[model samples]
Target: MVQKTFGIYTTTDTTAEEERLYVELGQRHIALWTAEETTRQILAFELFEHEMSPLDSLAEVLKQVKLFSRLLDNRYAKTQVIWENQECLLVPNSFHDREIAPNYLDLMFGNSVNTLVQEQQRPAEQMTAVFRIPRNWKDAAQQYFPGAAFEHKYLQLYYRFSNDPKGIYTLFYRSHFILILVKGFKVQLLQTFDYQTPEDALYHILNTCNQYKMDYDTTPVHVEGLIDLNSPMYEELKKYLRDVSTAEPSGEWQIGSEFAQHPPHYFLPFFKMMS
Candidate 1:
């Protein structure tokens, strides 16, 4: 798999943000750029940075994004923003089996009604994903990007990959990793973990495999995101699996020439959003 060194990228460019649609907001870094509204293809994109903390208001991130995005034009005219936060919960859509509990997340996170919580139901998939954007963040989004869509990053990847997965699929982010186990379109497991070292990440994947009775030695694994093909994490994974390869974004939008420069997997969720 190839690794995209996103940290080397800049925040946002003024004239460029005007031409396209959709932005990825993660870790106080705003990927502000445009995709063709008709084609939903990425035209040009740029990343913007602002200092932030878990406790800092998300408005700080929005403030910096507004400083760059709303310079002389209004993105709200046609463009939309997609927020990618990690805090989320997924519940199967078996209403008869379990009562829907929206407040369950608030207690888990120790936030109250002040949190901006939203849920999307993929009834065809029998799952409802509830995700959170900090209140300050939601307020900021509503102000500048009223048409914004909020989803947990994991859910975005989950729906896209789970539709027709085989063996194991993993998505590696800079901060953590997510795993989804599927056998012939049947999802057996969905999970996430935080890791500081390569071994920590390995342990979670291997342990999950063992628990699910997956043959770690033979199950083909597909992966995407910030992992390097020769990195210790990838090498260690290769030792356990018979086949491992970097996965490409599965759906379609007319890909722009500018997108050719970035790893295709880096924009998997963004493409999924547009699709």
Candidate 2:
């Protein structure tokens, strides 16, 4: 196995009685960070390898989350986790309180056995965001934030990129994580795929576009995260999509100037605030 880097970013002299935390949990890695409760501002962030597989890593990931929160002096704060499992769906908001409310994910992913499902309503529109969280994740989330919202990563991302004009917004992030979002007032498609080569990644992009019947030459493709102006992925994307370009996190949170140590588009630190 190869050893990769772990990171923590923060600002000192915090004074909140209880901080707020946001998490993005997945098979490859986990990200946890504290956010200002009212302003939705990011206070600190941490990233570490979780070595995820199809098998569950809830125990290990939450352990790391607690360790990082303690390091930031917010071990028992109000928390919300964004499960990046990518097994998700977005249904009509009207169905949220109906019979399908609890079974929306089961209906989509077809896992019949009882699972804890969570819902986030998109107030700006009449859409409901529904998804499955492993029972393990539901338990840990209850321990962390008993009465608050627990969500899926794509749900939060959907709200962030929901304003895009009927096209694709992709995040080629760290650890082979690709978040492909197709939005037009509502999310038409949202999937996370892992790729090993430039060809492999582009194939998925083109395939998704073709499947959706979105014109790559006309529909703008906005790229972000680990990719850059000189990357093979960027160059290849430009070859197929007419309006390919770098994208950034949408928020008013303060980013430390020292974060300049990394690429400007690398906003893993700010992602937690999307929830």
Candidate 3:
């Protein structure tokens, strides 16, 4: 069963024509947000969680997408969809070649016949993100929101944290988490790992630090997404890292009281994309 895990609708007075829609499609979650363009205030936010069995067919996934799209207002002034998945990699612009983009993924993830390869260039960061999305999901997204822009989730993170100090930044999801190591304004590592327990998550973070020679005793670590301050993962991280904290929400956007229902850091990347 698909469940609306979290929702906050603050306004119905504004027409869809005056709002912008942002949808984040991930492995197990669908989050939608609407904002008033003029005021730049978020009007509504909804998060849905679903489980997909290995036996499920492509049609089943498309059906879930259709059901989730109902919460999206098709008449919005503009819409952008952010695709979040594990099949992506970032390459420095100097070494990036558009014609051979598929080869990069093929070498990293082996050949996949059922996916569409795409790329996004970040001129400022001097990097290009090459990613693959399942063709069925891509077709469904195109059908639901024709002409809408699409972006990989890591591109947003790179834009948000590329300028920050040298540290390890992690964003947790249901079964997987993304870890980024940045130093000297350059990304050293940007990868995702699947974990079944808090120990598994800690092992990956610490192992990455060791591999990169980052001193866990001194290097800062900022975590966000679905993790909580009191959760075992947070406590475990604090035990090993000297400086660990939850990433703060950007002060630019004016969030309403409705957003207060959840921890400010829960949707850090989602809100950062608004800017």
Candidate 4:
């Protein structure tokens, strides 16, 4: 059974015509958000958690959730779906070839016979993100949201952080976290690592810095998602790194009042996608 762990439905009326929907799908959770089209204010949001057996597919899990069904019933002006997984590669536009996009993942994560491969180009960054989604999951999303656009989560983060000053950016999930190293308007490293403890997370961050010759004493580290300022992970980071802080929201949208209950950084990436 799918459980809604966190949610905020500011308005009961779901028939608004000027609303846009954004969804993010991960292995253990699914999150949906609705925003007003004209004002770009977040209206409603929900996060659902589910445990899948080895044989269970994402499509089947989505069909079993009631909130998903109700949300899908609403008509929206636009819908954007973000897929979150570790099977993604960022290739420079100068060296990218669509004909061999699948080969990139194949070499990195091995071949998967039951996945749909797709690519998103970032013209400004001169890079392309090649990724794969489960075939059944893609079909299920298309069946319900016929015109919804799809993209990988890393691509969205790349658009937001690729040009920032030299820093280490990290976004945490339940069992895994994404680490990005950016310097001089370019991404030096982007990869996901699984962790079982705060020590594990710190090891990867420090190790990455060491491998890339980044100074832990001077370089800044910014973190968001699923981490709290008081959490052990945050403390672990601050103990060794000179400047560590939680990332703040973009401040571009009018966030609903209910969102104040949670830390601003918790949903930083989701809000950034609306921009």
| Better structure of 2 and 3 per lDDT | 3
Candidate 3 vs candidate 4, TM-score winner: 4
Models ranked on TM-score = 4, 3, 2, 1
Candidate 4 residue spans exceeding 4 A from truth: 12-15, 53-55, 67-70
TM-score of each: 0.77, 0.79, 0.92, 0.93
Query: Alpha-carbon error at 260 in model 3, in Å?
Result: 1.3
lDDT of 3 by residue, 179-218 (tens): 9999888777888899989899999999998998988888
* Clash count, predicted structure 2: 1
The sequence of per-residue lDDT tens digits that candidate 2 reaches over residues 172-247 is 6554655555555657777777787777778888898888887778877777666667878778878777887766
Q: Which tens-of-lDDT digit does each residue in 204-257 have in candidate 4?
A: 999999998999998899999888789888888889999998887766777877
* Clash count in backbone of candidate 3: 0
Question: What lDDT is obtained when candidate 3 is compared to the true structure?
Answer: 0.81
Tens-digit lDDT string for candidate 1 (1-275): 11222322223343443444566666545665555555455555555555565446766566555555532144433555665665667777775223346566665566655566677776777787776665777676677666665555555556766767577777676756667788777776666677878888878888887887878777788877667777898898887777888887654765555566667776553456653
Per-residue error for 196 in candidate 2, Å, reads: 2.4
